[model samples]
Target: MSGPTRRPTLRDVAGRAGVSTSTASLVFSGKGPVAPATADRVRAAAAELGFSGPDPLATSLRQGRVGTVAVVVEAPLREAFRDPFALAVLDGLADELEAADRTMLLVAQPADDPVRAVAQLSSQAVDAGVFPLCGIRDNPVVEHLAGRGVPLVGSGSPDGPGMAHVRTDEEAAIGLTTQHVLGLGHTRVAHVSMNLGLRSPTRAARPDDLEAALYLDAAGRLRGFRALAGDAAPVAVAADLTVGSGEEAGRLLLDVPADRRPTAVVCQSDLLAAGVVRAAWALGLRVPQDVSVTGFDGVDLPWLDATLTTVLQPGVEKGRALGRLVRRALEGEPVADVGFPVSLRVGTTTAPPPA
Candidate 1:
């Protein structure tokens, strides 16, 4: 004859368990240690009262901490998760964020998306946001999130106002690679770069019918290559920064008349370099003996028959940097731009170019 069984409140549980509301709250929240017997009594009472727990929304509003980070990317959901560089960078960020007791909310911005997905930004629940290895120029997602006063950090350079950044020193990395190739006494050097467009005047302009458009990674490496090689640098763009792209680039370079072919090829990634080496062998050219190739990224690539002469950037370290930055921003600390240096690993991929 009761209208409907009244929903049990924390007070009902506390009253039934013969404890103060504070004790009942502590036991339920697991924020404090309680005697096993006392905890059991509270649970028993809560079960009898049909009270599961406090409402998450009410609790979040009171505490003002959402405990989630928004990881925003400039690609489709699948592509964002698939790309190796993106994966590595995110792995670093996620590992650190998890260690700090925060969760990740991955959001990918599609290229062909017409209406900016910025309408989805809501700091009403998330602690902060991250943009790893991509830009935010004309990006509504970033604008909306930051406009909502959500603290922001990026795995790469900050693309907008007040966003913290933790990035590898691309300029330094390129300079190191170029110097290494030059050190090998190879004057005819070519760059099989990643997609270009974000960082150069020649970005949107296709290098030729054969080259792919520019990307940020390619632009930074090309900048370094040109700086070191001067006016007569050899460069080509890849449709993508994959091993296949490297091999195709290698074949194309080799097909370039011998007098114009690059004796040393520097690729944007280890995979590309491996491909170039494979393609070179296919053309009956000896690595280092006929053409030297170098790659970026210290990723273990035994598939490459030759030891890649490359630089090892701390992928884990970079991830940790992003994590720390995210944590700092979440804690309301002023996060600044972080730059990690690169180390060179000289492998057998390079020798004096063919006599």
Candidate 2:
């Protein structure tokens, strides 16, 4: 049997193409200037010799930059992406990163132990880091990455010095729905909050829970609702940001005696509000007639029959804002915290309370 043939190299391709190895490299990297015919010849030779391209490791070593950005999310990939708002933010972030010729290295940080993310990311090489969603107010990953001089960007959590943020006024944003319900003459209002910590159960929110909350977004929104609705207003916390959790939270607030049940239910997310609607229906309660429902993060819900009164958060735009902040930081520009605004969208789900 004949000896195995040697794998083709850049030198072999260049020789076959009648060009210098440097010229072959230029064609492959799309750098410097090369005639069209020369480039074509190099590609043909590469094809025949089965030479794909130069080594990525070599290229990165020479460039002094790894073109990957670390995108940190505080949940498992499937769980996080299940929320439409999360998907929108990710899509927008991916778009801008693609435009800048960078790739994303997704890092899912466990909520129970955020420090675990630090270990996972320690071995990875990334040009910058992003906390793309609302996570714990403080994170060990922030400190580790900051010590390494990684450019960091975030939205409303993992707050610390030197990190640029696309800040959302969580309190004012949730107030959009709270004020709307108040305007609709609903005095008996209930709030559904996203989980304030890892493995939190769906149950009534207590004053102590708000005081010790780890998730700032949820805490801020709860404060906003309390600010308008009063501190004694009933509030339920979801186990997670899921429809199922929302349904559970809804039952806690809605499955009560008619007189005690809140006339209007305001949720921190559309998914939770939809769940409340389902729970209300299950209990033979007609929406807007028995209970008015409102939500935050105006995500599209095709399965629900009624349009939701919600806070128009524009997740994609908020994501792009985060991306821009990351880009600016990477470019050595002085990036200040950017404020993202939210608006109230009136819909069929909210109406004047039943007489």
Candidate 3:
């Protein structure tokens, strides 16, 4: 048999088209000026020889870019998708990447073994990485990727060399809602916080937990609530970012003697606030009538009967902000932290505490 069939290369196409391989490459890559007729001839030749474009790996090797970004979320994809805010952030990031002819590879960091993510990504080539959801304060994957010189962007956390962020004032953001309820004459107040630090359990927040927490956003919001609510304010921790955890937290705080119960509960997230609402209803309490509740991150919760009084942090815009930072880094532009501002929305969920 004649040797095994040879795959057609750009050289073969160029030979048939009566053009140089360089000219044929230009036609394929659209990286240089080429006469229309000549470009047509190269395509014809490529078609005749069944030659596809250049090998993507070889092209990336020559171009020094893989056109892939690692999107690291602290939770599993299933859990992340359940949160509307996470979905919007991801949607915005995807929009920016698609416009730039790039792709996103989502990586979920295991709460118990975060280093596992580093090992999984060590062999893959990426132009950059993003932590759209603020991650652990010290992340191994960030260290591994940064060591490899991949540009990094984030909403917050794992911040250092080779990483830029679309910064948010978590402390100030949470304070808006806390201050809102406090302004309404609710003295007996409680705070519901997301888990602080990696692999934290759902329970009452202790002073030590806030001090040693690795998750910066959660810790920051908790501190902000305590700052305005005072040292003796009751605080409960959610197991995760889900509504179920929020409800559990709500039950912990709301299932109490009426005289001792808080008049308002300030939550760290909208999902958590919804849970608190359900818990209140289950206990025969009317929101705003019996208690005023407020949440951070004004995500849409159509399922809930009442609109949440929340801090309006648009998730999609934040994602786009993260994308913009990533794009700048990819272009060799000097990437710097950009501020992301949030405002407060007063909805039906808050009012002067019950008479």
| Lowest lDDT block of 10, candidate 2 | 198-207
- My TM-score estimates for the predictions, one after another, are 0.87, 0.93, 0.96
Error of 2 at 46 (Å): 4.5
Error of 1 at 325 (Å): 0.9
Rank the candidate models, highest TM-score first. 3, 2, 1
Candidate 3 has what TM-score?
0.96
Candidate 2 residue lDDT tens string, 232-255? 999999998898998998899989
After superposition on all CA atoms, what RMSD does each candidate show versus the true structure?
3.7, 2.4, 1.5
lDDT of 3 by residue, 122-192 (tens): 98999999999887888888889988899999888878786889888999999999999988988999999
Residue pairs in clash, model 2:
none
Off by over 4 Å in 1: 1-8, 112-116, 122-124, 136-138, 198-215
Worst 10 residues of 1 by lDDT: 197-206
